[model samples]
Target chain A: MLRINDLHASTQGKNILKGINLEIKPGEVHAIMGPNGSGKSTLSQVLAGNDAYEVQSGTVTYKDQDLLELAADERALEGIFLAFQYPVEIPGFSNEKFLRTAVNAQRRHRGEAALDAFDFSAMAKDKMALMELDPDLMSRSLNVGFSGGEKKRNECFQMAMLEPSLAILDETDSGLDIDALRIVSQGVNALRREDRSVLLITHYQRLLDYIVPDYVHVLANGRIVRSGGKELAVELEKTGYGWLEDEAKSGEVAR
Target chain B: MKTATPDKSLTYRDVFASGQAEEKSWARYAAKRESALAAVLDRGLETRGLEEWVHGKAAGLVAGDALPVRGEVAAAGSPEMARVAGSHLLVFVNGVFDPARSEIGTLPAGASVQPLSAGDEAADLGSVARDVESSFTALNSLFWRDGLQLILADGVVLEQPVELWFVNDLAGEAGLIPVRNLIQVGAGSEATIIERFVLGQAAVVEQPLTEVVCAAGSVVNHIKLVGGEAAGEHFGSTHVVQRADSTYRSWEIVTGGHLARRELHLDLTESGAKCDLNALYMGAGKQRFDLRTRVNHDAAECETRELYKGILDGEARGVFDGLILVARDSQQTSAHQTNRNLLLSDDAVANSIPRLEIYADDVKCSHGSTTGQLEDEALFYLRTRGFSPEEARTYLAWAFASEVIESIPVLELRAELSAVVTRTLDVVDDTLMGELS
Candidate 1:
C-alpha cells in the first residue's frame, strides 16, 4: 500500500534522508530503528509531507497515488497520519473539537457525509475509552498542560479517531513510562487491521516488544542498511548499531 | 465648516464646549488633560508614557469636533431586552439621551431610578462622580442631558442586569460626543450593569466619552459590546470605584471599529474590594484597536485581575497598555495583568505593554505580555489530523477568543459577538465549503 523509491530529502539546506527505498503491503507493520541523526524521524516527516523538509529527488506513492505531490493536509485526508515526536500544545483548543474536526475531515475526503455533533460526540466517547483518556481532558485545551504520557495517549486517541490507512508514529514511546507504554501499544494493537499499515519509528527495541512488527529496518546515515524480521530489533538491542556501522563501512569498501 | 485635524489638547477643548449640561459642570478638569497632551508633545509618544492621549493616538484615533448625532434608535427590541431586569434602562441615539426608547420596569422593592437632570435628591452621591473627573469624564458630564441613577436600599439583590444602550447613528458629520453614567449601589446591595454601544453611521472618525461610578459595598458587572458600521471610529472611557467589600467586573468586546480606543480605570479604594477586568478585540481590514487601563489598589487586601486578548489580521493594529498600582499603604495586595495578541499577517502589528507600580513592600504583583503569530507546529498538528489549513487557523483563532467571550453574561450577545469575530476574520461562512475548509 506504500512505496518509496530513491527518496532524497533535506531540511534547511542540510541533507537528512538520502536514497531511501522501501515498500510495504497492506496488513503489514514495519519498524524503522536508528541511532541519533540517522534520518529515522526525517523519513517519517518526509513521508507525512512536512513542508519544512524539501524533497530533492524521489517519488512516494500511497495506495497508487503520488504522495509527494500532495500537501501536508491533503496527505492527511488521503489517510496518512504522522504522530509527531513532540506533539504541539494548542492552547484554548479543546481535544473534542480537534478530534471531531479531524474525523469529519477524513470522512469528507472519503466521499462520506461529515458526522453531526451528536454522532461525533458518540464516536469520540467510544474512542476516548479505547485510549483510556479522561472525558475532562478531552474538554480542556488540546495538550496545553498535559503530561508527557497524556500527550502520547492523546495522539493515539486521535489515531484511533481518524483511523488512518497508514500510521507513522515518530518516537511515540520516548517519554512514556511502562504503564503508559503498555496502554498506548494496546490502543495501537487494537486498531490494527488487514486493510491498514503501520510504520513504527523508534530508537529502542522496547516499543517493538509491545507492537511486534512484520519486518524491522535498520536506518543509519540516511539509508536503510539492514532489513529483517522482528528478531533483528532484539539482536540490535543486544549488539548495538556499532556492528551495523562496521558492515556499512565494509560494504562501502567493497563498492 | 470642516477644520484641520485638531491637536489632541484642542480636541478636548472642542468636545468640552460641545458637551451637554451635565458634562459642562466638570469642564474645569480640561487643564489636566491639556497638560498631559503638552507632556506627550514634548516627550513624544514613548512606550513608557502612561498618558491616555498617547495611547489613543497609538490606536490611530483622530478626534473630531463633534460626533454626528443621527438620532436613530431601534423602535422595538427583541423579547430578551425586556426580560433583562434593571433599575432603569436609559437609551441614547447618536449619543443623545432618548427617553422614548427606554423601558424602566418595576423597580426592585426599596430601589429607585432617579434621573440626574431631575434635581439630584441624592446629591451627596454625585460627589464621587464630580470628584474623580478626567477630561473625558468632564466632557461626558458636560454633554450628558439625562443619566441613570440607581439607588438600592440596604441589603437588596437585583437579579436582572441594568441595561444602558448607547447608539451612534450619526448620518451627517458630527464629532466628539460625550456621554455620562452615575450608578450608586447602597450598602450590601447587589446589581449588574450592562452597557451596549452600537454605531449606526459611517464617518471619517468618532470621539465619544463614557464615565461610570460604582458606589460603596455594591457589586457591578459591566459588559461593553461594540459593533458599528464598518467605518466607525470610537473613543470612550469608563472609570469605576469600588468601596469596602465591593466587587466590580467589566468585560469589553470590540469587533468592528475603524479606530477604537477605550480607557478603563479601576480604583479599589476600600479594603477587601476586588476587580476583574477582561477584554477581547477582533480586528481585520486595517482596523485599529487600543485599550489603556489602570487598576489602583489603594486599600489593604484588595485584589485586581485583568486579561486582554486580541486577534489581528490584514493590516490591522492592536495596542494594549495595562497598569497596576499598589499604593504605599496597600499591604498584602494582589494584582495580576496579562495581555496576549495574535497576528495573522506580517504587516499586522500588536504592541502590548504591561506595567506594575508597587509601593507596598508586602504585595504580590505580576504582569506579562506576549505577541506572536500562529504557531506553525500547532498548525501542522491540526493539518495532519485532517483539518484544512484554513479551518485549522480559524479554529485556533476562535478558540483563543473563547477565553474572553465566555465571560460575557448575555448569551445572545456573546454568540453575536463571536459570530462577528468569525466573520471579521473570514474564517467561516454559511456555505458547506467554508465549514469543510
Candidate 2:
C-alpha cells in the first residue's frame, strides 16, 4: 500500500532523511522506532506533503500513485492520512464539521454523492462509539482546549471517519497514558482491513504490546539499521540502542 | 480676513461650495458648521504633522463634481414583511423614510418613530440637537431630508428590536447619499437596534451621522452592516452619551464598500455606567476602511472594553485609532482597548494607534495594537491534516478573527457575518447572503 525509494529530504539546507527505502503491502503493520531528532517525524511530514521540507532526491508512491506530485488535500483524497504528533487547535470550526468536510472531500474525489447532515450525523455517531469519544466534544471547536489524550483519540476518530487506505501514525503514543494507549490501539485495530495498511512511528516499545507489528525497523542516523519481527521491539526496549549506535558508526567508517 | 479660531470661525461656504448646488442645507446648521469646520480645518484632516486628527484622512474624496443618481428609486417598503417576525422595522430608500414599508406596531406604547419634516426639530429632537459639534454631524444636520427618530419613554421595556433598513439604489449614476438618525432611550428602558446600509447597482456614496442618548438606568445595543453592489463611499459619525448607571454596547461590521470611514464617540457621564465596543472590518482590492473611536469616562466607577479586528487582502488599506480618557474625578475607572490586524497579502497595509489619557491616579487603563501574518506553526499543523496551503491559511485567518465576530448577540446575524468572512477568505462552499436577502 505504500512505498518509498531513496527518500533524500532536507530542511533549511540541513539533510534530515539521507536515504530511505521502504515497502509495505496491504493488511500489514510496520513499526519504525527511533530516538529523538532521528528524522522519524520528518519522514512522516514529507510523506504527508508538508512543504517546509525539501525532498531533494526521493520519490514516495502510495497505492501506485506518485504521492509527491499531489497536493496535501489531494493526497488525503487518495487515502493517505497522517496522524499528527501534536494535533492543531482550530478555533471556530467544530470537530463534527471538520470530520464531515474531510469525509465528503474524499467521497467527492471518488465520484460519490456527498452525505447530508442527517446521514453524516448517523455515521459520526457510530464511529464516535467505536472510538469511545464523547459526543459533546464534536460540538466544540476542533481540538480547542482538548486534553492530550482527548486530542490523540480525536486523531484516531478522524482516521476512522475518513477510512484512509494508508495511515501514518507519527508519535501517536508519545503523549498517551496507559489507558489512552489502549483505547487508541483498540480504535486502530478495529479499523484494520484486508486492503488497509498502517505505519506506526514511535520512540518506545510499550505500544507494541497492544498493537503488535508484523515488521519492526530501528532507524538510526536517518537510516534503518536493522529489521526484524515484533520481538525486535522488545529486544531493543530491554537492551536499548547502544549496539545499534555502534553498528551505525562502524558502518559509516567502513564506507 | 479675521483669524479663524477652531471653536468659532470659518464658514461652510469656504469649504463645501462646489459651485453646483444653488440650494444647500448648510444654511440650517450654519452656527454648528462654522464652528466644527473651523476645528476640522485647524486640525487639518488628521495628518502626521498635526497634534490631534493625526490619524484622520479623507476616504478617497475626489475633486470631481457630485453626480446625480439616475437609477430607479427603491420602491417604498411594504408593511407586511414576514422575513423577521416581531421586529420593529423602519425602512428608507435614497435617504427618504418610507412609512408604508415600516412595521412599527412591534414597538411598545410610548416609543415613537417620527419624521423630521413633520414637526419642528427643536421640539422633537429635544436635547439631542444640542450634542452636534463635529463637521460630519453638522453636515448631516443641514442636509438631512428625513430621519427615523426612535424615542422610548421612561420605564418602557421594549421586547423587540428596532430594525432601521437604509436602502440606496444608484441605478446608473454615481452620487452621494447622506443619512442622519437620533435615538433616545428613556430611563430604565432597554432596546436593541440595527442600522443596515444597502447599496444598489449604481456607484454611489452614503455618509450618515447618528447621535444616541442613553438615559440613566437604560441599556442600548446597536449594529451597523454595509454591503451591496453599489460602489459606495460611506462616512459615518456616531456620538453616544451614557447617563448614570446606563449600559451601552455597539458593533460595526463592514463587508463591501468603495471607501468607508466610521467614527465612534462614547461618553460615560454617570457613575456605575459601562460601555462595550467591538468592530470588524474586511477590505479587498483598493478598498479603504478607517475606524476612529474615543471613550471618555467622566464619573467614577465607569468601565469600558473595546476590541477591533481587521483583515486586509489585495492592496487594501486599513486604519484604526482608539483613544480612552479618564477624568480626574473618575476614580476606580477600568478601560482597555485592543486592536489586532492581519495582512493577507504583501501589498495590504494596516495602521493602528491605541492611545490612553488618564488624569485619575487610581484608574486601570490599557491599550495595545498588534499586526501579524499567519502563524507558521498553525499553518503547518493544518497542512499536515490534508488541508491545502490556501485552505490552511484561510482557516488560521478565520480563527484569528472569530474572537470578535462571535461577540454579536444576535445569533442569525452572527452566523451571516461568519459566512461573509468565509467567502472573504475564499474558502468554504456555502454562503448566507441569499438567505439574508
* Tens-digit lDDT string for candidate 1 (B179-253): 555666777888777777776554534444434455567777788877666566777667677888888888988
DockQ for every model, please: 0.52, 0.31
Give the per-residue lDDT of model 2 (tens digit) for B1-437.
01111211323344344311432333444454455445544433223454435665654332223322212344543323232456787787777667777677755687876654443353424244333344344445544555567788999888877787777654444555656777888999998888887766555667777778999999998888876642767777777899999999989987677777888888898998999998888898988888989898999999999999889999988899888999999999999998989899999999998889999999888989988788776777665555667666776777666667777777667777777787788764342122111
Candidate 2, after superposition: displacement of residue A126 in Å?
3.7
Clashes of 2: 2
lDDT measured at residue B83 in model 1 versus the true structure, 0 to 100: 29
Docking class of 2: acceptable
Candidate 1 chain B lDDT trough over 10 residues, lowest sum: B70-79
Q: Which candidate should be chosen as best, given TM-score against the real structure?
A: 1
Q: What is the interface RMSD of each candidate, in Å?
A: 2.3, 3.7
For model 1, residues A1-255, the per-residue Cα lDDT tens digits are 999998999999999887888998998999999898899999988888788899999989899999988988999988899988999987666777677777877887788987887888888888888888888998888888899999999999899888889999999999899999999999999989999999999999999999999999998888888999999999999999987767765664110
| Chain B TM, every candidate | 0.80, 0.82
